[model samples]
Target: MKRVVFNQKGGVGKTSITCNLAAISAARGLRTLVVDLDVQGNTTHYLVGEIDADAFPAEAQGAAGLFKQTVGSRKMHQNPDSFVWETPWENLFLLPSSPVLTQLERELESRYKIYKLRDALQKLDAEYDRVYIDTPPNFNFYSKSALIAADTVLVPFDCDSFARQSLYSLMDNIAELQEDHNPDLAVEGIVINQFNSQARLPGELVAELEAEGYPVCATYLSASVKMRESHHEHRPLVDLAPSHKLTQQFLALYDELESGRA
Candidate 1:
């Protein structure tokens, strides 16, 4: 599965979802690769421990390549795996990212290179069993590329009124992508994150989303100290606290996604 965990809205747990899903998928013995397309490099940070800024046409081995339109298809396809890093987990790998991707976007946007990533991934999708893309906070070239390359998409939404509006807008964008670029890409479901059921507002918002017919993912990731600490330690929540309540929730969610697939 080529899955993109995306949302235009920031602070909605996109990286957390991407990382956890990748880790779980890899742990299941499926060769999983995470493509960090976010300029924030949070995914890259958590996975690779650091981002290398200086790999030119060559991506610093499993490091995220800045979308290079001029790089031949042969070359572009070779780089993602070249930058693929070995993680603490057995089967998980990462294509790390850096701040340079921000500038790469500006350069490509002018050339109308909207589907650069999709074009690149097509040449190499056969190599990995699962590909998870961690997109940037806003809808930009990377976001478009993720949507285009995805076989499945997931949106991690927060519990807030403004995020609700952004969620609708994101769905509209996905619809457009489905119509024009990727017809087969399925939107798996919505993962509600940073949720505090004890709080009235978060619970209320989850209710609203469910009532509105949103496919709320079975797992609700809570705002937990361990979740935050795991990122700083450069590991997954499951690795950091396998028995943690939130970690168990994510594990169960992973099982559902794995089994529920048609």
Candidate 2:
């Protein structure tokens, strides 16, 4: 299955969720590929440490290369798999993000290459058991392409009042995208991230969302300093601190998603 972890709001744990979930999937023995479309490259850094810019050309590396190949005379010559990079983890692969994505966006949009990602991923259906896409924080060219390519979208909610208000606008945007671009795309669930059980506001906000009929997943990810340590170590929680509470919550969330698929 192809799943895109998306949110128009930053600091919502999109990178952490995307990388950790893909890591869990890989650990479970699925051939998982993570496509990072965010130019910030947080997902790339999380999976693979800082890349040497001089080692490769922007137009020939990672997601930028994949999208770059879609335009001009270079189109369709390279296999989509050729752009993928291997991470340190077994069964976990990455199509790392590059800063050049910002430069290529206008040309890609002007050429109407929104469906290129979907087409490429379809061709790769046999090569991977699961595909997780990490998108930019805005509903821009990259995020829209990811939404168009994905089978479902997992939204991250940070349990803030401002985030709650933003959720409405985010839902509306997804609804519009579903109507216009990807009719088959589904909202897998709203993952409640950084939940503090001792806090009254978090519970109240979650109750409000559930009462309003949102698809809130039962597994809530708690905030922990270990997550930062995992990031600093450039390791996913499943590999860094599998027995930690946050890691267990991630495992439960992963199981919930797999069960839903089943």
Candidate 3:
């Protein structure tokens, strides 16, 4: 299953959801590949603490070198093994991104680019049980490419009025992509992140979203200091503190996501 965790709004925990889900899938021994479509490289930086390095795992390095092909390079369309590499985690790989990925629009403007990413990914020899795509916060080419390639999408929300409304925008974009580009895509569910149960607003928004036909995940990521610390320290929260509240919440969400795939 190829799953993309996306929101057109920043600060909605898209990276947090992407990395944690990839980490959990690796823990389960699935050869999981995460494509860092976000040019910010937050997912790449969060996993490895940096993006530019000579000595990356095979999968990680492979992922980074992928977009370097000029979209029409003679080297383009090489086997996934040629560009896909390993990260620090077992069974988890990344297509790492650099500042250069931000130039994809300028780079791929001329090549017969109909569903380019989908075509490229379909050529890969790898058999990942799951592929998670981390998309930038917009309905641009990068994100639309991911949406077209993905079998399912997990929309991440921050539990706010505007944030929830952003889901409408995202849904509309998804509708457009499915009609014009990919017809097999489906929305898996909505993931509510960075919640504060003590606040009345989160509770209210959850109900409102559910009423609007979104299957809300039972697990909600908490607004925790440990999660912030994990980002600073560059470790999964489960590795940092398995007993922490946020860690357990992520684990629950992971379980829900995995079960959905099953």
Residue pairs with backbone overlap in model 1 = 61-82, 61-83, 62-82, 62-83, 62-84, 63-83, 64-96
How does residue 134 of candidate 1 score in lDDT?
94
Alpha carbon lDDT at 198, candidate 2: 99
Question: Would you list the C-alpha lDDT of every candidate in the order shown?
Answer: 0.79, 0.94, 0.77
Residue clash pairs of candidate 2: none
Which candidate should be chosen as best, given lDDT against the real structure? 2
lDDT of 1: 0.79
- lDDT per residue for candidate 1 within 1-262, as digits (tens), equals 7889999998889999899878888888988888988878898788767543454343333333536533445644444455566777888887777665665666677877777677666766787888899998888888888898888888898888898888888999999989998899888888888888888988888889889988888787787888789999999988788789888888887877777641
Candidate RMSDs in order: 2.7, 1.1, 2.9
lDDT of 1 at 249: 85
Per-model TM against the reference: 0.89, 0.98, 0.90
Q: Which residue runs of candidate 3 sit more than 4 Å off their true CA positions?
A: 52-64, 73-77, 109-114
Displacement of residue 191 (Cα, Å) in model 1 is 0.5
Sorted on lDDT, highest at the top, how do the candidates line up? Answer: 2, 1, 3
TM-score of 1: 0.89
Better lDDT candidate (1, 3): 1
